[model samples]
Target chain A: MHIPNGFLDAKTIAVTSAASAGILTVSLKKTKAYLEDKQIPLISVVAAFVFAAQMLNFPIAAGTSGHFLGAVFAAILLGPWEAFLVMTLVLSIQCFVFQDGGLTALGANIFNMGVVGVFAGFLIYFFLRRLKIKLSISAFIASWASVVMAAGITALELAISGTTPLIQSLTAMVSFHCLIGLGEGFITVAALSVIFMARPDLLKEKAFSKKITGLVAGLLITAFFAALVLSPFASSLPDGLEKVAHNLGFISKEAPSNFSVISDYQFPWVKNKSLATSIAAGVGVLAVLAVGSGFFLVLRGREDGA
Target chain B: MGHSYFDRYRQVDSFFHRLDPRAKLLWMFFFILVVVLTPAQAYTAFLLYLLAVFVLIRLAKIPLKVVFKQSLIIVAMVLMVAFFSIFKGSLEQKLLLIFNVTAKAWLCLLASILLTASTPFELLLKGAQSLRVPQVLITLLSFTYRFLFLISEEVSRMQKARKLRDFGNSRLKHLKTIGHIAGNLFVRSYERGERVYQAMLLRAFKGEINTYSDLRFMQTDVGFILITTGIMLPIFIFSILFTTQY
Candidate 1:
C-alpha cells in the first residue's frame, strides 16, 4: 500500500526514510558489481516492463480486477538487488509524474513494496526450490506470501505510527490481503508457466555463494526471533490464531491454564488439533497447485488447439 | 498521448517556469517539509500555507481545475485515512485527525504537483543529478521516463488485440489470456532492449551518460526564495506559539 504523507507522523517518516535510504544505497552498490554495460539496458527495459505490466488489469472475480504488483515477478526474472532498483524507480516516477503516491512517504512505500516484497518473495522461492518444489508452484507460494507479508508490515507501520490500533489494523489488513494473495499467487503461476513454455532460456537462475547464503540465513533467523520477541507489543488482545480458535469453540474447558506447547498447537477444525493443522496446511497446498495447474493446462491446451 | 498529462504547463511563460529547476525543486522540498512538520493543531498556519500555494498556482498560471484534479488522488487517500480514524478516537479527536491529515496531505501534494507541472521531467532529472543524486538512479529515472509512455501504448494495443480476438467469457480464461499478453510483452521488451543497447553502442556509448548543464541562478530566483521564506517563517513561528499556548 502507498502511504500518503500525512498518514505517518514525523518519527515514523524519519526512521523509515533513513532505513530505506540505507538499504537502497547498499542495493545500488551490490547492483554495480554485476551490472555490466549490456545489463544496464536490460535493467531499464525490465523496469519499464514492470511499469507497463502494472497497467494491465486481469479479472479476479466477477466485476472485480487486480493488476500485478511485479515485485516478485521482477525478482524472479532479474536478481533481487536489481529488482529493488527497478521498483524504486517505478515508484519514484509514479510519485513525481503521476502523483499516485506521496513524495514524503516514498521511502516507506519503497521499503514495504520493493525491499520487503522482493527479499521475502525471493527467499521463499529459494527455500522452496531447495525443498525441490516445482518452479511454478514455488513462484505461486512466494508471490502469495510476499503480498501478505507486505501487508503485515504496512499494518505494523500504521500501528506503530499511532494511526490505528495494532490489532485492528493487523486483522483488517491481513484478512483483506489473504484474498488478494490468492489472486497474486494465481497470476504469478500463470505468467511463469507461460514463460516456461515460450522461452525457457530466460529463466536462468543465479547461484549465490555459500557464504552469502549462510549470511542471509543467519540474518533471517535473527529477524524471525526478533519478531517473536517484539510480538508481545503487537497487541494485548488475542492474536489472529487465538481469536479464530476462540470463535470456533476450539478451546477445551478442561484444558490446563499453563502456557503449554501442545495447547498452543490447537486447531478448531478437527478433534486431533495438531494433526488437523498439518492436514489443513497440506490441503491448502494441494488446492493452490490444483488451481494453478488447471489454469496452466487450459491455456496450453488453447494454444495447441489454435 | 495528450500534452496535458506530464509537464503540461512547462512551456508556459511564467515566473515559476523561468526560475532554475534546482530552485523550484528546493522550494518544493521546503514546502513539503514545512507542511508535514507543522503541528496538527496549527489550523491558522495551515490556512496560511494553503494561501501561499494558491498564490504560487496563480503565479504559475496553471489552470486550477488541472491542479485540483491532480490533487484529488491525495484528497481521496486522506479521506480514506480519515474514515479509518473513526475506529480509533473520540468525536473531537476524530474531527481533528481528519482536518489535520487532510490539510497536510493536500498541501504536500499541491507542492509536488506544482513542481512537476512547472518543470519538464528532463529538467527535474537534471536538477536531481546536479544535486548529487546517484548516477544509477538518474539513469533509471531517465530510461523509465523515456519508455513509460511507449510501453503503456504497447499495453493498450495488446488489450485492443485481445478484445478483437473475442476471448471467452470465463474469468479463468480471461486471466490466462492476460497472462499470455504479459508474457508476449516481456519478450518483446527484452528484444527491444537488446536492440536499443546495440544502437547505443554503435554511437560510441560508454557506461556513463553525460549531459551539459545550462542552469543559471538569477536575482529573481533569490528574491522569490527570500520572499517565500519571509512569509512562511512568521506563520511557522506563530503556529508553534499558538500550538504551545493550548
Candidate 2:
C-alpha cells in the first residue's frame, strides 16, 4: 500500500503533494486553535502508539495476518485533524527511517492513508451514528469503508502513474481489500468495544468536529464516484452497493502518453529516426550538465556571485 | 533500543560520512531524480546508477554484505511486481521492465541508505528542517523517535505477557485479545503524553525541540555533488549509444 519511489510520475507526485500539504496546513492550524498546547504531546504519543500498534499482528486465516492501520481508530479517538497529523507522523517516520515507502511518493501515501482513510472513517462513523446506528456497528462499518476507500485510491494512483491498467489494478486491489476491510472492521470494532469498557470518556471526546469544509466533502464524493465508475471493470461485485470506483481509464487507453515524452527514441518531431536519437542523446547530456551546474550554483556559486 | 537499529554504521568515519548532511541529502535526491527520470529501457543508464551507488556505499565504509541484505526487501517487491507483469508483456519484454523497475528502486534505496547511515538522525532532520520541514513536525518526529523504542519495547513486553497467559486456540478470541492489548496501549500512551507534557512544562520546554547547528556546506560537499551530477551525462550517452534497440 505504501507507494515506492519511481513508481509514480512527476505529475502525480506534484498533485498529491499539493493536496496533502494544503489539507495538513489547514489541519495543523485548526487543531492548534482548538487544542492550544496539549494536543501536540498527545498527538505525538498517539503517533507512537500507532507505530507500536502496527506491530500487533491479528490472525486472519491460516498462516496469514494483517497489522493494524489505526487511521480510523485515531479519528474516532482524537478528531480528524489530529488523526491526520498522527498518520502523517507515522508515515513520515516509516518513509524516512524504515524506508517502507518512497521519499518522493510521501505525499501520495499521506493523501491515500491519512486524508482519505481518516476522513472516510470520521465522516461515515458520524453519519452512521446520526442514523442511530450502534456505536460498535458504526465503527465497524466505517473502518471497513476507510480501508476500501484507501485501496481504491491506491489503485487510482498506480493507474494514473501508468504502472498498470486501471481495470486490472482496480479489480485486483479492490477485490482483496474487500476481504482486508473485513479484518479492519472486526479489529476496529473489537478495539472500540474494549475502549468503551475501559475509558468511555475517551470515546465521548469530540475534539474537533465542526469544520469539515466543503473541499474535503467534495474530494470524498469525487473519489467515491471515481471508484464507482471504475468498479465495473472488476466483473465481480457483491451487488447492492458499488459506486465509488473511478473512470481514470484513459492513461492506459492512450497507450503512448507518458513514455512517449521520454521514450528510447523520442522527440519525434524531427522526422528522422536516427536524427531523433541523436537529438535525444544531446538533450540528455545538456540536461544533466545543466542540472549539475545548477547544483553547483546553489551549493557554491552563491558565495562567488555575492 | 531501536537507536542502534538505524544506521548501525553511523559510528564509522569515512569520506561520505564526513560530508555535510545537506550536501549528502541534496546529492542523493538529485541522484534519485536522474535514476527515475531515465527511461526504463535505458539499461545502461541503470547500470551506471548502480555503479554510482556502489561507489558511494563503499566510500562510506559500509560492508556490501550488510547493504545487500538490506536490499532484499526491494528485490522481493520487484519480484512480486514482475510476477504480476507476466500478464502485460512477452517474457523478454517483461524481463526488461522488471529489470528497469528493480534497478531503479534498488539504486534509490541504496542512495537513501547511504545518506541515513552516514548522517545522524538529528543532523539529517536539521538538513530537512533547512529544506522547509516545519518545526512542529520536527519536534513531533524527534519525540516520536525518542519514544518509539520505549513504546515498541512496551509492546513486546505486553506480547510476552499475553504469550505467558496463553489459554487455547479460539481464533476470534485471539483477535479480541490483540485488540484489547492495542486499546490498553492507546490509553496508557495517552496518559503518558499528559505526564510527559507536565514534565516538559516543568523544565520550561516551550514548543520546539531544537538540534544544535553544526552542519556546514564545505568544499568536499560541493565536489561530491558535482562529480556525481557529471557522471549522469556519460551514462545517458552510453545508454543511447549501446543499449537502445535503435
Residue lDDT tens for model 1, B104-204: 78888888888899899999999889989988788778877887888888988998998999465676677667777777888788778788888988988
RMSD of each: 12.3, 9.4
Query: Cα lDDT for residue A160, model 1?
Result: 50
Q: Chain B in candidate 2 has what TM-score?
A: 0.91
Q: Which regions of candidate 1 deviate over 4 angstroms?
A: A59-64, A209-233, A238-306, B1-4, B166-168, B244-246
What fraction of the reference structure's interface contacts does model 1 contain?
0.45
- Candidate 1 lDDT tens digits, A1-306: 788777676655765676567657756756775554546777788788888888877665456566778788788877677888889888888888877777788988887888678877777787788799998889888888778877877776665555654566777777777777777777677777777877788788754323373236324533532352244333334443553564365544432211111123233443243334334433443443354345445544754696
DockQ of candidate 2 compared with the true complex: 0.32
Clashing pairs in 1: none
Model 1 lDDT, full chain set: 0.72
lDDT of each residue in A127-237, candidate 2, tens digit only: 788798998899888888888888888877765554654556677778877777877777788888878888898998464445444234434534543543444333323
**lDDT of all the models against the reference?**
0.72, 0.72
Any runs in candidate 2 off by more than 4 Å, and if so which? A34-38, A205-208, A212-306, B233-246
True contacts kept of each: 0.45, 0.37
